[model samples]
Target chain A: MAKKNGLDGYCVPFFDDGNKSKFSLASIDPSSKPFSTGSKETDRERLAEIGVLLDAQQERLHAQRVQRVLLVLQGMDTSGKDGTIRAVFHEVDPLGLRIVPFKAPTPIELAHDFLWRVHAQAPAAGELTIFNRSHYEDVLVPYVLGSLDKEERIRRYGHIRDFERMLAESGTTIVKCMLYISKDEQRERLQARIDDPTKHWKFDVSDLDARKLWNKYQVAYEEALAATSTEYAPWYVIPADSKTHRNVMVGELLLRTFESLKLEFPPAKESLKGVIVE
Target chain B: MAKKNGLDGYCVPFFDDGNKSKFSLASIDPSSKPFSTGSKETDRERLAEIGVLLDAQQERLHAQRVQRVLLVLQGMDTSGKDGTIRAVFHEVDPLGLRIVPFKAPTPIELAHDFLWRVHAQAPAAGELTIFNRSHYEDVLVPYVLGSLDKEERIRRYGHIRDFERMLAESGTTIVKCMLYISKDEQRERLQARIDDPTKHWKFDVSDLDARKLWNKYQVAYEEALAATSTEYAPWYVIPADSKTHRNVMVGELLLRTFESLKLEFPPAKESLKGVIVE
Candidate 1:
């Protein structure tokens, strides 16, 4: 609820509206560089600058030991989630950052509710955490695979809305990004991996099967993002066709979010002023 | 076991040695510059170089997805554990590093065995985790406060040995460092914190009480390190009075530990040979 203004233009419309059919993934272009600085080199430099600022802010957050930050990244194959993390956080200290990549659930994870494991990894006080893929996977994956019915998916989305609301109320700042890429882009990326034997370990043939259901996945994403996007945990659709652009946009968004917190180091201890080290 | 030799001069002898009296905290000089590059400026430069090397090794470990690395840091107040983590891991990818700081136990944690909470935070495969303070706290605190009997302390040490051996056998590389700062050094550090009012948030008057019992804490540390140091899990005594020297030594030690693993990117996948995107 503490989110800054005008970001709503990039947000998926909140689901509070009774007629829920207005939002569409096709409305946004995946190749647009709206957040770019017009020069790739300039954008890279700007991102590095933001990284420095972000690090200072993060240290203040840690020193203050107050708020928590959670960034959730959800994207299709080859959407550059990992690359974005490596680039945007390249300059941030590893001491205060926690990156959790959610993979297919184990038997025990599946035994519990979808949110159980996710809640376990939520950022602690003064911590910054990222989920490479997150609870949204529950809505998107099962829906795309046709294992989840419409009403059940809706119910889960409601649960997510409630969950994020609770986190916000309890002093957490949340940001969710849905990495949007064109089907054509996916084809090129997947084929490149297939052609490069060295990259094969990162590719799975099943990805091709997922590509076959491209439209269905997009629809699933559109619905989930729309329903779960709230003032407390708004979802932003990121244009991720260009890796550098994607990294810059994500970094910029995160810097803005952190600055919104207005973090400062705790006031110097009055008692220690003028005291000397031995 | 993959640890390099000549480094053994800094290592506390493995507890398997029956007689632990030879390892004494008083024997090590906290201000020693054994790993320093002969000049403060040169030592800083060396530390930066090691950061880059550590980053590369960490990436390979992540790509291999086979082994885990755990670094345990224990030191008296202001001994520079946090500073070392920031400076040494400055270049590492945030995605591959996990820093877990163990604090005083919560009600739930107290109900379980001391190692229970620690076991849950151990590094996963392909992870390089640093415990800002660790299970060693369990040993040191109770002994220093006279809450745990000597026999119970010895038993806890056995539990740690068994637990760590299992981690190593299951593919974890463990390194523990006890940052050894002389009581005089601690007094200076504590006084500096007290004098700087901005740092008051980090200081507790109770810290003065701990300083009052400095000798007792040192003896407790000596016993615990001697008891828990093992072939699979070694404890190194880091001379930590000079911040630059401490950072350099820890950086060098970690880089060496990572290099000994011989980690490499997995062999290029053969199945995608000649395949093309689209």
Candidate 2:
């Protein structure tokens, strides 16, 4: 049995010709850390190393000033979306990175097409951007809450596939991750916040309402990921119960993805080689 | 003689109740490093310490979920706006910082009121946002290019002061910095970029056009900073000849500003005190 090595082995294959039901989200274990170095201490060290490598690669990308990269992170509450960003990109210069966190839509956002806000924040030339939450919220929330019909959900997913394809073709490398956590883990995390007064600012009663609909959200995610995963923008399931492992895996995945771009510093200019400052 | 301490000494005095010209930009030296720890290596180490402290403060701000902070960076070409962000924010979580780089406006942006695009990107509650270049461009670029008459320029500065005051009154703490670098320093920085072929992507031919109007831009900046510096939104003149000193000064300034906020994690919620997860 050949052990899964890199992130490609975990990517949900591109959905073509309406095969949205083929990928099963439940089969993956939420506790597995295939990318981890087995020891938690070693995993932290590896993540730090990845951070430096990522910082260098990002500098090159910004220097080249051509391609753009967008990372979309979607997960249940308390699944470490914020932690992963802080840890994995600690060494990457914040200059080249744009992190956009989408909260509930405001009235102005609701007035436009679902993708309007997302598109406005898309990475520009020489930029690497991350969507903390994304337009995927539109399909996931409405569908799970029964506000969107099955046909409408499928249509929206199709629209997402097309939108991502266009961005990919226009020089963006799109990577999506769903941080997977078990229901039991969520209970402990939510309870810990409740136990500490200082953490109350982070807790929302409405979050519990969403937790009540966990199964539906899980199902919605499965369908959405299955429908929109493409050769241009593939989705990966990250086991996120262990925070260190989650950071390590995400760091490795992004490092590998960036390396695949083969980004390089543009050739030196010959026009002003001998030019000296006046 | 007593030495000036903290960021207040560099701060452009607040233009309150129609007082504007009392502070002069020319009085500040672009080469001074009042905030440095006397040695370059020590200043760098101090900056790393500030980075961690700022990072912790930012986390507290995020946890509090109330106040917002906006850092507006304005400078001459090659005056280290991007470098300041990268070095000062190295330890801060990218998740908490939002960097908005304002390039030359597009036709759509130009069609709206100058502040329209900017207002849309204001820091939301709990966000620490940086405007790499901001609405100040409206005052400097046009006034220097002679497209905007002094009367119109003054009116625009009034508009900016009001806009920033509004952002401030709405619980946003605004700290603006003008990275001051000498003409000779900028010439060296720009020429070095031109001399390095790999750095061509960062160059714009139009940047040279701006450099040609250096004296005019400086005059414009001095006037605009004088007029717009207000009680609620103050601007600091950061000596930026030494990149390390620039970073250290910025880090200290922001750290001090954030500390003044007295941000704390929200108090524990009594409602969920004994509630256990099902």
Off by over 4 Å in 2: A1-5, A17-19, B1-5, B17-19
Q: Write the per-residue lDDT of candidate 2 for residues A1-278, one digit (tens) a residue.
A: 11122676567766863456678887789988888878999988898899999999999988888999999999999998988898898899888998988988999999998999999999987788989999999999998888999999878888898899999999999989999999999999999989887788889998899999999999999988888888788899899999999999888889988999999888776666776655
User: lDDT tens digits, residues B76-171, model 2?
Assistant: 989999999988988888988888889889999999999999998899888999999999997788888789997888788888988998999999
List lDDT for all candidates, in order. 0.86, 0.87
Top candidate on TM-score is: 1
Which 10 residues in a row give candidate 2 chain A its minimum summed lDDT?
A1-10
Q: Could you estimate the TM-score for every candidate?
A: 0.95, 0.94
Point to the candidate with the largest lDDT. Answer: 2
How large is the i-RMS for each model, in angstroms? 2.8, 1.9
Query: Candidate 1 — which residues are off by over 4 angstroms?
Result: A1-8, A17-20, A268-278, B1-5
Give the root-mean-square deviation of each candidate in angstroms: 2.3, 2.7
Best by DockQ: 2
Per-candidate clashes come to 10, 3
